[model samples]
Target: MKFATAAAMLAAVLGSPVAAQNFTSAAEVRPILDMTRGSWVAIREYGGKDLVYFTHLLAWRCGLREIRYGFNGAAPNTPFKMEQCHDGAAQPNAISGDGVFVSQPGGSVKEVRVKLIYDDGTTDEARFTRDQILMR
Candidate 1:
C-alpha cells in the first residue's frame, strides 16, 4: 500500500502539464526598450548588391495576435504591411522556437517557421532562437 501510494503521487506530479504564464498585451514585453517608440530592425544580405531592411511590431490580445512589418522609412502614402502573429498562447513576443518546436502555454508545443522581409525586396527564413532577437 505504501509503495502504491508513493508511485501514484509521483505519477500525478510528473504527468501533470506545467501551466504556462501568458502575456496578453504588447505592453507586457519589457525587455524591448522603446517598444512603443522605435521600430525593431533586421538586416538581410541580398544577392551582394542590395541590403534589405525589415522592421516589425508585435501585440497580444487574448492569446497572441498582432504581427506587422514594413519597409524602413516607408513614405506616408505607402501602405504599411502587416500580418496576424501567433505565439501558441504564450506571451506576445516572449515565445521562442527553432522551426521544429515552439514552447507555449500549458506546456503545449508547436512547429512553425518565421520569414523576415526587408524593404529592399529581400527575404530570409531561418530557425530563430530567442537569443537572436533584439527586443528594442
Candidate 2:
C-alpha cells in the first residue's frame, strides 16, 4: 500500500499543469536568436508592461540609426517617437531603436514576435516562437 500511494503521488506531481508549463532552455532559444539577427521590431505595452513585436526589415546591428513609432490595427490614433543611442558609451547611440516583446517573469528567456519601423519609413515584421529579448 505504501509503494502504491507513493507512486500515485509522484505521478500526480509530474503531470501537473505547472510542470507542463516549464520554461524553455537556452538550446530552445538559439533558433530564435538566429532568426532575429537582422529584423525590425516594435515596442508596445502589454499587460501593463513593455513587449516587443518583430517587423520584416528592422535588424540588430552596430552603427548609426533612427526609428519612429506608429500604430496599426484597431488603435491607429496614438503616435510615438524614437530616439538615437550610441554604443552604450553615452546616453544616446547612433543606432537608437525600440522593440516590443513578450517575456517571462524574472528575466527568464522566452519567445516573442516584434514589428519595427525605420526612419526611412520602411517596416520589417516577423514572429519568433522562443526568441530571447533583453528588456530596457
Top of the candidates by lDDT: 2
Enumerate residue pairs that collide in model 1.
none
TM of each candidate vs. truth:
0.29, 0.27
Best by TM-score: 1
Alpha-carbon error at 64 in model 1, in Å?
Answer: 10
Q: Give a tens-digit lDDT track for model 1, residues 62-133.
A: 222322332223222322234334546444443243221112332111111333333333433333222233
Question: Candidate 2, residues 18-99: lDDT per residue as tens digits?
Answer: 2232112222222333454444453444565545443323222212133233322222222323333333343222334554
- Model 1 compared with the native: what TM-score? 0.29
The list of candidate 2 runs beyond 4 A from truth reads: 1-83, 87-103, 106-111, 131-136
Clashes of each: 0, 34
Q: Each model's C-alpha lDDT?
A: 0.31, 0.35
User: Against the hidden true structure, what lDDT does model 2 obtain?
Assistant: 0.35
